[model samples]
Target: MTDYETIVYVERESVARLMVTALRAHGFSPREILDGGLPGIGTGLTGKGLAIAVPASEARDAQPLAEALLKDMVGK
Candidate 1:
């Protein structure tokens, strides 16, 4: 099994997809995990969020670019 490192947590699917696209555009491979799938009938409802992760080795190389992308995204 391969271990993945969590990079960013996004509350909206659209934001998550945008982050993924940005990562890809910057030449970094990222993965998205949709948490809060149905389990105990509404138990995980509040946990519905998306997580973006990349390989541990690539994290350091991707951080600056991701940060810049996020800055542009959030208008910071």
Candidate 2:
């Protein structure tokens, strides 16, 4: 669990927060990677997008749940 593996990317911070809650409920320590898109300013400065990631050791187990949740939220 030394490294983190990104599981899904979402455009909205609200969505990322939802994913964080879902992952926490599943007993996973999820981390948020915020790439631009500040509160009022869409896409922020970086414009790289937002991401939800889990520790490398838990990635395999967390990926499916993360993807399912993201798909449900964004339809992608």
Candidate 3:
């Protein structure tokens, strides 16, 4: 099996959620990681930001799109 690696890290949970949805719509298996673990209630309040991760094998392809989405969201 392949390992998973974070492709993008965003400070806002909203952006992280959007990234997960966008990545999923593109057929990539994306997951949200909070403080190095799966997210739960009160997690986002820690102030440590969140991450969007995908399989290491797909990281190269997903990184650009993830970064682009993040940049776009931050612009608005």
Candidate 4:
């Protein structure tokens, strides 16, 4: 809870929103997520890409979910 780490970068706007929502449903914190696709932003998750953050300790669990989401989105 001290700090969150940016664990993955998702390029699609829709996918990024889904990732943040799904991660919360899966028990991650809203505060821990950074949706790069958020409107009206200037930097970071803005134009760079949809970047997501999670507790460093939770990265192990986050990895698979992130991968699966990205895989599913990319495959479509």
Candidate 5:
């Protein structure tokens, strides 16, 4: 029942999990939301989309770290 600010949207579960791990590594707690890409409950059941959220106060610090981690993951 807590509110969270969306930090990133990822299509792959692996990436989302990795992001969460990386965020935690840097001392930020993150929450994942599986938002169905399609309409209705079916999307929630079978969607490949995901969202990573963190506390509003932590978002500013988390973003750059997350971006860096993702870049490292993607080899960019």
Candidate 6:
């Protein structure tokens, strides 16, 4: 595992939710997703829109799967 984390940004909350689900299916904890928008804006919090946080330990495994899921399903 590395010493750093990475973030993935998606345009829509539905896509973010889908990514969270896909990551979970691929063995990620639900907590890994940052849920970075929509709710944030609603609550008057600054956000980066839809985002997921890949913890350092999970990043190596999660990256490819996330990219695939986003590309294949979300058309990212």
Top candidate (TM-score): 2
lDDT of each: 0.69, 0.78, 0.77, 0.68, 0.72, 0.65
Top lDDT hit: 2
Model 2 agreement with the true structure over 1-76: per-residue lDDT tens digits: 2688888666777788888999999999988545554467543355655667888988999999988988988888
TM-score sort, best first: 2, 3, 5, 1, 4, 6
- Among residues 3 or more apart in sequence or in different chains, the pairs in candidate 3 whose N, CA or C atoms overlap within 3 Å are none
Cα lDDT tens digits for candidate 5, 4-67: 7877656566777888988988899898544445553331343534667898889999888877
lDDT of 2 at 8: 69
Candidate 4 lDDT over residue span 1-76, tens digit each: 2566776777665667778788888987534434344465534445666567777777778878877877887773
Error of 3 at 16 (Å): 0.6
**Candidate 1 Cα RMSD (Å):** 4.6
> What TM-score, computed on C-alpha atoms, does each candidate reach?
0.66, 0.76, 0.74, 0.66, 0.69, 0.65
Cα RMSDs, all models: 4.6, 2.9, 4.2, 3.9, 5.0, 4.4
- Candidate 3 regions with alpha-carbon error over 4 angstroms: 32-48
By lDDT rank, best first, the candidates go 2, 3, 5, 1, 4, 6
For 1-76, candidate 1 gives per-residue lDDT tens digits of 5566766555556667788888988888887545556554332245644557888888888777776776777665
Stretches > 4 Å off in candidate 6: 1-4, 30-48
Q: List ranges where model 4 is wrong by over 4 Å.
A: 30-48
Error of 1 at 60 (Å): 0.5
Error of 5 at 27 (Å): 0.5
TM-score computed on alpha carbons, candidate 5: 0.69
Residue 74 in candidate 6 has what lDDT? 60
Q: Model 4 lDDT vs. the true structure? A: 0.68
Candidate 5 CA-lDDT value: 0.72
Better of 2 and 5 by lDDT: 2
Preferred candidate (lDDT higher): 1 or 3: 3
